[model samples]
Target: MKIVREARHRISELGKAAAYSKFGTDVARRILASPADSVVHKYVKTKGLEGSVRRLASESLPPGLYFAKLTIKQWEKHRGKPFRLLQGSSVVYGNEVEPPARGFPLEYRNIVVTSSDVTEFKLDINAPYELKIGRGAFTTPQQVKYDAQYGVKQYGDVFYSLRGNTVNPKKLLITFPGFGPSTSRISYAVSYLKDIKEADLRDTMMVCFQDRYLAAGSYMMVDSAGRSLYERVWSVLDGLRSEHNIDESQMLFFGASKGGSIAINYAKDFPQAHLLLAVPQMNLPYYFNKPFFRDNLFRNNAIRSSEQPESLLRQYFAEGRKIDYFYTNSDELSNHSLIELAHDVPNLTKYRVDGGHSAVARAALPSMLGIMRNFLHGAKNKTFRCENIRSYARGGNVLAQARVDNQASKIRGANWYLEGSLGRTKFMHLLTEHSYQFLKFTSDSQVLAAAYDPIEAMSGLTALEANGSRWTSSLPEPLTRGPKQSPGAVLSFDELVLTSTSPREYVVLDGDTHGKYRYRSYEVDPAGDTMEVHFVKDAALSVDTMLEANGKNRTSYVAVVEPLANWNLADLVALRFVIKAGAERLRIVLHDSSKRQMAMALLSQVDWKNSQVVAASPTQPEANGTSSAALHEKEALLSNAR
Candidate 1:
């Protein structure tokens, strides 16, 4: 156990060390100069006698030559006006405001800036300097001396690097790494090309950047100097493409969390830019309440008034953004981000992988690599899913077969990784001898396995347990795999489809929600017309809407979707209730556009052994335009529960 933990720690260290090694971006082009010695910043130019005093690193005035004010202020006055920086007494020097008459500061005094700009302001003393600036969002480095004391290097501005073959490549993969432990160093998430050996990428360029802001790092597109990190990233990409003559179709952006946000934002304007993002927070300002972010990054005027790529995702997707978004099914916040925005993504691929937020990378990275390899080799689009993992008892061992839906594609080579609760990893290339294949393993400990197939798509982490009961699930119809053969139907952002959904089902809510985040992922609130549903714990769905029964309480997880108050659903509506596995029964009340209950249906879990009906006939509408259906408690999926 100790060895396993120690191994993980060592691997982590190696990852950090990688930044300073061969994988490091070229730092020769520094965006913001490393803080120079003996420099004071953020001195306010005051119009009056006594203004707000700004202090420097070393406060004691040990007798210095002449005072040179850094004169830091935003260039725009309509955007914002100017302020004053005072040393001791105001000595006018043109419209530059007044500085202490030269050669006077031989004693202890902090620098002063007249005017209130609550953003991060810096002050230092040569003999005491003045700072003058107007209102505008800006960013400055935290005290360099303090950062250096911890042996952590810090860069104050957005920095990026472009490196790779840049020759004859199939696609250029732009990787945006997630947040680092600190914003001090430039972060690089895993670069797929480094591990790839395909002939196509031997000449493609990989670009990455640093989060110029602090704490959870940067907002990706905004820098403190009021520069558009968004425009800059695009410009860099355009330059590279122009220089290399690469087509737009051959570009891809990859990132998760913070990196995911940037990757999504960068490709917004460019419809051809493909995105592979995992568990990304759609809104940047959402994290501002955290002390670190609030103190260092969000408070700046530049950040507050900057062009937010925050919620523009809906607009981008509305204008045809091809995004492959991945999120852990159990993570409510990330999932909610998707539910709130523009509906019906043009070509969006969603993966409801197992585990929490941290586990997204494990699923996304391997899948990303496979997609990259596919693009390089000109492979068809394919997605492999572990549709089921059931425990089959043979002798005293519980054998499990992970039914992988390969979409009937030809498999060239497949590799699988298995890890036990103790952190032991095993690899295999098991061949499918029959339509159903079971991997044999029997133990009291927990185990997870991933079939890392290097195809157009792959599966996320799946777990198996020993001595667990077995169950079977039956689909009502053939599952649709969106390819050239069958048409794929997409549910819009405004559409009321959660998780795995079919085209035969649809619903209309009463109202719309704009910029309101009142409910968490665990809370199911169908307030007014908009539906806000969240899973309790491990429940989640991506592409489908069918739900299996829970042995304890299928109704324990309640979802309330709002209904229209005056529109009839008959003209455009399809609805049904289907349950599998353990759900005892489910009762749904039919509603007219006027929000009146007309009929009801009760669905029970399929009892394959008895071959019994799992669905109930809808009750006839009541004469008063309202109907009620009741189910016995013992046989109910949701009898009295709301």
Candidate 2:
């Protein structure tokens, strides 16, 4: 009976081996046999990171375990066919209904744990697909080690984490991280702790601002009856200067995008601090992501022109500040503010790269750190090709122009990458495949990336696609010459600017700040500046909520105002913003109905004063600030001023 049982067990083992052999053969035939089907090996080689990674195509291996390879574009096109995720990475997942907005998380999309069920189920996507998925994109950071190495220091709502040589450090670096989902570490720049140390940077003490005011950051510019975040940061930095015994000259300010803007703003007071900014959003008011940030940070949508890089950068006129703006030609909105600022800025070093706005910050980081290393050694970095990028908007179409001081340098034939608000998703459904055109050669100094708006009256109506963005190629003039401009009001740039701001307050872009370089736009009472907008109800147009609530808020106040100009925030990174107000709080909520948003101010915990009471002090700008001017742009375009 025992011999019979042993024979049966051997037979069972042989059967299992045969089943494995059969399944392996089937996987090889389906994936490795066909040239169309890439054997998605669960394992492939990579650099820096261990284990398998992904690239384009690879030769077939003796498939022990493999799946299929296809792109969302390929599968989406001929969808019914069984294919895979092929080209430039796009997540193929289930349960998640995220709009795949730019900079969205990837871990939730790709990862599954042991507690998960992997049984037969119909995919959400109405098509079939396969994948030889590599190890998931989820990994735990050494939190215990990092926690011991770093300690946080908070001042009011503004705070920063200090790391590196804290004991009598030679050089100091204050880093600011741009907009990243706060599910992870808010001190993202701290992740580069190891990288900066290994670069042989001197005994440097690094300061990484958490900047996680509401979500990610409020630009660290909150002010109340108490000391403002600015003052608190000032006190902290002033203490650090004495603690580290390092002056502004020996310190380096580094940031990318939003972080860069903050660094630039702070560095205005300390021009000696070397600045390394990348694709920074200089004009906060006109920023595409302003609504999300504004709603999160401000009490009202009153944006201060003072809260911009251009205003801060202009302060470096008397003294020289080694300001290096590591910018990518592709960052469209950022260029609008940066290019305009570059024209008048002195001792400004601009490093132009060819990459995306979000990606270029990280991509340019190594070079940015090298600049810090140079400061540590009191050396100069002359490696990067320096050039200035300028953009000119005429008849609603913008032309990105490049210039260089070096006659030997070729700016004409360099690659200039450009993308509009809609990026690649414009072609998502129409073409059944989605991608954006990024590279345009400076190969011809004459090459230009021009933006065309069909909706801009008859701004030629050259490029037209229903609900789609359009950027004309590197054509010298009117890209692929189409329609002639219809007779319409050709508004100058100043007029366009005037229309956006209040008529009563002529915002002098280059206003005199007496002596305070930090004080930005000064509202000079332009002789008899008044607007007759028959307000059925008392109303005022104010952007102060979006910027700073200078003085105290009056308890007796109007809850809301009428409409102003409507801003379309659906196309850019259309993340829905839901307003959750506390009891007895007044919040200006943007109810997105068919992509249209309500432009309102969040006037909670705010004190206001009537304009009639402050009429005596018309010249007093902060007095004018109390009488709020709110823009309401929901369905009807109107404004309310009180």
Candidate 3:
């Protein structure tokens, strides 16, 4: 019996070997003799990430295994054939029923998933042709037609992991994009559209504030009234919170430039709303400051502004009083004036950056987004960004001197380095960017005098008081006219007096104290010649280091010019300087959103620490403060960025 079994096994093995030999020979011969199909040639290489990775190493190989001569096209072809196309409902009874007749015949479309299925069914897009398996109709013309013509036909499967239950929806980050005057004209256009499915951000619930009257093609301003227009949309948001299941506590407000101003004003008026202001406008004075007679649009409307410029501006200015601006170092339009107003009002929080008007967008986008998420969800301990003069000055090869401009004489100084050259042109660029008024010296005169425009008083704009207030004796019109003198000796006789006519405000700029100095003499002639006396202003002038002339004499000043509502912030960080006297009299106060004082102190001499100041007075300018220990923490706080 064993011998008979062995004989059968041998016979079976020989038969298997013969079959394999024949199959191998046929495949080899076909490869060697037949011309390759164009489809196969085209599939010679792969594409995309999967193809690239596969070419580098096969999934089946060990970590160190070597892959050789593998083409990208060949590997990608493994996924050949388009995604499955489904037609007609897969319901059990769907195949048995006849499609109802109508203007368009009721029909069904089908999708094939597997290779075997594709082979069994064929796609014939010919006229009036029916797809038949046996003979019974399976689909309706309307259903099939809709699939072919209207449905999202080309996109692959979109899987959404439903996060945060419907009972408690996740916080909605409403980012209001700031378009120019022409674009943000209406409520619906500028709002984030809810129907776009092309991007993953589709779920973000973004609303754009676009120009309603003028399309994106025509750049124009809407003159009807931006405030009223925005209020309508804001009312919609209120409805969403009250009527719908919106997570009201999780709503975040974001804006830049004009939009920033709107966000801040809206939040200030509606303190109950959970909104994070990212680089809010310093003030709304910009719109009225520039003359506008061009066409402005409203809802399905158009109007020219030649008739009511003053009245329209008056309305706009009234709205400006309601906002609490938080700007940054990069804000060229409203940084200086915003910071000035911040000192007067406690609600404002200011930040500083190194970029232009878009600095907050560029530097603080991620941080602002995170904070907004927290604020909307009722998260606690949310922190914000503040300005860092030392770091900013380092970027422009300049120095920063900060002081408390209150009536007290408390002032301190520190040295800083701005990144750029202190050459003549660069200095002027910094001035314009920061809105620093140029002291018309007529020539390169050491004695610099700054003039002022009366309108500056209305806007809270401040510059050094006229040079007339800081001189004791008459000197040459331009210091260049006088003979050169020693670094310490007086070259020209000049009087120095400090006065504040607009308001009793302290000069807020770099280099106000006497402890640190880059150069020794106030009016020094480094290359000495025969000169009698050099006239000098009070050493306490508020001149930014970057704006300081780069001659042999490097003496700078910090004058308490009239207070301003807003000034360019980008220019402030670009300045740096060293303190030569009055380091003990410096004080900085940090305020909260309620127009209430939160923190105060003398400016820190440390590089980057959480510095605080004690309220030397029991009450602040607004009659709100406490008697607390004077503390200075030398660290960066987002809350102080403005």
Candidate 4:
């Protein structure tokens, strides 16, 4: 046993040395800048912080700078007493309470005590509580003692690496594999966990282990086993924390696929730790009981039971729970799970993108970083809702922006179109398996919308169709039809335009919003086919009515929209919108004229509903109405002439 333990330690050291040997001197210096104080180290010295450090380590990477040891400990025992067996009946044919009926005539029995043993390996590091430092590994072995406390038991292997520099205090991310039936193959989790920790992230450490093989992918085990494993993990974490000064918040739990489920389970048990996971099998029952996947029991073991995913989620309501779920629209395992969870847990955030089973690499990582950054920076509520839409709009130049809201629900980010750009204004928003692209155009009204890879089109938003169409409409209304009614008609901001009297002032001669109001404009265009309009508004601004014009000319018109309630426009008053006469206009027959024209013409007249335009006929003085067009940039505004 000593020899085996010694060999494992030597191998670990050798591996570390080899890794260090590969780095340039500069890189090596960066990794080993300076060692920080560790609560775990002190705890280990007094054996006081073992459990705490172990607890912290289970969820995070060690903070500051440090190294860790991955070692195996053997847990076994022997029983000296003879074990007894139960026979069918007691026969007293011969005498002396005939030796309990052996089998048939002359069947013999021997007394022997059944013995059981288990193996558990621990991976750890000593660090401050604020910066949990340590690694842990676990796995299920084949042919484990059937009567063992936990059906299948074995600890995984943990590997260590440095993160963060003297300049930046780092956070640790520790990953746990879903299930494994052996120690050898289970170590794969450890290797990959370390690799991912090294990329892109600067001030973070990663610790992980391979999953043990269970049939094929089954990782579920009896509750007793899970508890025992959890306890062992908890013990190591306790030790690390008591000895090290690692803060619970600095530690993060991250995992993917089967590992992701493991991460969630750990966080559910220990809510104080920061948790991050992608495409976790939260709904394990659905995964295992599926008729099509009936043959697999290996990975299924780690997430055993035929219960609903809701039942599994119910296990996480212990006191204070903070967990983040990342899933791709293509992730069959977690896509729906995330949505369902999103509805219930306010703190639960579902990061959706475009991708499949391998959601982490394709979708979760890139998007997750932004979320983690917010979390690490002490963001309140820390939960963000994201959607896709163009946010950058500077007279044709548009960039994608990520819209986020604070705890008070106040929005943050530049305004472009569609109420903060539907939260998809940045490259960070993941809406299914695709990573959204922020778009901008140098001149045209066009903006870019793209994904990392192909994905199903959003329900209301169509995927790029034939000839690369930007959007496909599915609503019952005409996919390309204009608003049926004005005044009462609700239209999106992009659908309306306000003529700018100056660069900073605007009047709505034609708009879908209700109310007579003035607005502050950020931009104006008079030379292009499409003029850009940016304005500040209040509730009083609104559209009155949109009317379709009769006649083969196919021209449309609209009426002056009145406010539901009167309002005050302190700075700019009224509005005038410039549009591609037909694009933003509706076909409407207004009292103003029999001929069809742009909706702006009817809306610009104060008595647009009662006045009429004479076609070469003498106009009656009573037919005249008040005109507010000249007050603003009527030059850019549509004319009342039909």
lDDT of each: 0.37, 0.37, 0.26, 0.32
Q: Rank the candidates by lDDT, best first.
A: 2, 1, 4, 3
Model 1 residue runs over 4 Å out of place are: 1-158, 167-170, 183-193, 197-200, 213-216, 304-310, 339-344, 380-492, 495-642
Candidate 2 is scored at a TM of 0.41
Kindly indicate the candidate among 1 and 3 with the higher TM-score: 1
Tens-digit per-residue lDDT, 1-642, candidate 2: 999999997897576345335443354333322342233532211122222111111111222322221113223243223222222232222221222224423122122111111332223344443333321222224322343355543333354677777777877788876765433432233324455663354477788875533223456554311123667777777788887688778788887778877888777667678887777775564453332232223232323324456556655533656776676545645654233223323556455454467766555444455556566654431222214333444442333432223431322212222321211111000000012122122332212222222112111111111112121222222222114434222111121121222232111111100000011112222221221111111124342222114523322111212222223221111111111111121223222222221222212111211111111111234324333333332222122211
Q: Write the per-residue lDDT of candidate 4 for residues 1-642, one digit (tens) a residue.
A: 999999997998576444333232223332222232444344353755333333222212112212222122121121111111111221101101112122212111111111111112111212111111122212222112221221222233112223433134355456655432222222223324322323334655444433332212333222212222445455545444444455677777766666766665555445577767666764554344222233233123333433333344544432335666655444433432233213334345444344356634443443355445444443322223333333332321222333222321232221111111212211112322112233211122122222111111221222211111122222121111112311212122221223322222222211112223333222222222222221112322322221213432222222232222233221112212221221222221122222224333433342111122211121332134222211221222335222
Q: What is the lDDT for 333 in model 3?
A: 35
Clashes of each: 37, 41, 125, 142
Residue 556 local lDDT, model 4? 28
**Per-residue lDDT tens digits of candidate 1, residues 573-630?**
1121111111223323222322322212211221111111112122443323332233
Q: Specify the highest-TM-score model's number.
A: 1
Model 3 stretches with alpha carbons more than 4 Å out = 1-172, 180-227, 245-249, 282-326, 330-332, 340-349, 376-642
What lDDT does model 1 reach?
0.37
Worst 10 residues of 3 by lDDT: 423-432
Model 4: residues >4 Å from true position, as ranges? 1-171, 178-187, 191-205, 213-228, 290-293, 296-320, 335-341, 372-642
